[model samples]
Target: MKSSESRLGQWPLLAEAARRDRLGQALLLVGDEKGCQSAATALARWRLCEGSGEEACNCRSCRRQLDAHPDMRHVRPETKTIRLASVQQAVASSQSAPLWSPMTVLWFDPVTAMTLEAETALLKSLEEPEATTQYLLTAERRDQVLPTVVSRCQIVHLQGSIRASRPFRPEYLADRGRDLQEDLTAAAEAVRGRYLQRPDPRLLELFDVLVEAHGGIDRNLNQELTRETVAMWWRQTVGPD
Candidate 1:
């Protein structure tokens, strides 16, 4: 029930939640990485700040020993998505006592990308509460999560880092991807469209360049070299005209 505006023009709306004693055992923070992390860090700091006036802080929760933290377990995705094995390990570790703080935080940054199976395995832990454990799950979008899982926690919206998008002239060619051939083909179509509008011989030459690259694919030519050729051509083709 907080406004869209961020706290300090950066952090998430966590003041109201903390004031009302409504920071749930399982909290779902929805937004960009920076804001959600700021809120999570604020929560951690607030808890530790009570005991330590300053440094020599008896709160040994966040001292980075190699890769692990004592009272916090950050469950990161293996590659593109969180795996069931990672969730299971965090769930199993959830039972252990917090070495420093009163509660332990198990954080999953942007749980939206979690695979169906991984989310299912995590769903149980979210639904069931542990007296000494706090679940901090983040997401870029709320819709990415399972409805049942979303229902079980206190949802906090955050102001993520807004980035300015690089301008792309051809709308169709804007969605270029890793596949060099696919993007080159789209660029060729872009050039054809340009030629239709302006009747430029240069565009026809660009179209031929893309076609020549496509031709190489049939000959089992070196893709990396061909892609580099197209990239250099594209760079040289743009600007001042």
Candidate 2:
């Protein structure tokens, strides 16, 4: 596994901007979901740091740790989809002034989880800006996000390729079993992102394979057999990575 330092090293400009407190108001991070989420956390911690601690932080931020930073709010999907209410609450929080830190950070990991209405509500927040609030949105796929939302922020692609040659592979339908539904959705969305980047017909076919496998699993088909079948399909389709 790669360390955060190694992963973040590829994004020097973002790190420099964060350290200097000059990052833009909102950023659309496109990459692996875990990597994007971690990047957002690191950026928020640096942006709110007081430049006084031995390791990183000092003062109020130090007491509770950056993990518990008062001014940082991480809004993720409680279920498979982010509801409008959750987005609305996050918007209200962002609209408020910062408390312990110089700025407040509104982080939405994998903004693709947001439902249609939720995205609309979030768009309203993006349309209206507060001087002290910074928004960080991460998505495993690009096309899954609304163009309006994408236009509101600077886009950053943090990864070179989809880790899964295809999403929802019977073996990798998920990323370590975080959540079945969410993982499946994220996986398909990720494939869509890959297709968008290269306009590959193969990616769409891979995505279709994922959906069919999902349906089979939902019907209580033998998971082992399903996985084997999917693996074979993947091998035939993609052929040796």
Candidate 3:
């Protein structure tokens, strides 16, 4: 896997923000987890770096960030969900000044994993922006995130080249009929191939719909309904052939 700085180079808007020191206090990065993580780390390094360009400088702050700086705080859920205690800790940390760097970064990966109470607590901090602090939130899917939290931050959608090392397989349809499963498998492969080739917004949207439909099936949703949803997404995104 590539570093966040290297991965972020493909995104012009985000790269420009980091390089020009124009990044906002709150940022909601939506897309693949790997890319989002790299972008978040790249943004943090850019903010702390003393160099003139967008890339990280060889300054003390940049060096410390590379090695995990003390001022950089990471808030992650211990279990499957983020607790309110974690949000409180992050909020408290945001109030303090940076120990070494010019700015303090609070990175929350998979922000959608946060519980309602945790999100509420984090919302309060976002409402009152801090000058010397930056909040970076990454989500694999945007729709799963709270609208209020989404509204408080600048949203960045990232798309990177999809590696073909792992081919598409419809494992979620294991309990479905064999024929239906075979059809879905073929559809999944087609969508995956198109996405790998182009990686356009339409294909990304279709991919998100496929992921949601898979989750819907796991939750005991109507199999026919899920199948229809996937079919609709395929028609709308990829169309015929």
Select the stronger candidate by TM-score from 1 and 3: 3
Tell me the spans in candidate 2 whose CA falls farther than 4 Å from its real position.
1-10, 19-22, 52-55, 160-241
All models: lDDT? 0.62, 0.65, 0.66
lDDT winner between candidates 1 and 2? 2
Candidate order (lDDT): 3, 2, 1
lDDT of 1 at 110: 67
Positional deviation of residue 178's Cα in model 3 after best superposition, in angstroms: 34
For model 2, residues 1-241, the per-residue Cα lDDT tens digits are: 1122332333543532343343568888877867786677666665565554223334567456655777878888897988889888878987777887767888887789999999988888888878888888999876789989977876655553223333444456323444443344445555555566887778667766655554444345676665566567666755645
Question: What TM-score should be assigned to candidate 3?
Answer: 0.60
Q: Residue by residue across 13-48, what tens digits does model 3's lDDT show?
A: 454344434456888887887888777777777655
Best by TM-score: 3
RMSD of each: 17.4, 13.0, 9.3
Candidate 1 lDDT trough over 10 residues, lowest sum: 159-168
Question: Model 1: runs farther than 4 Å from truth?
Answer: 1-13, 47-58, 62-67, 160-241
Worst 10 residues of 3 by lDDT: 160-169
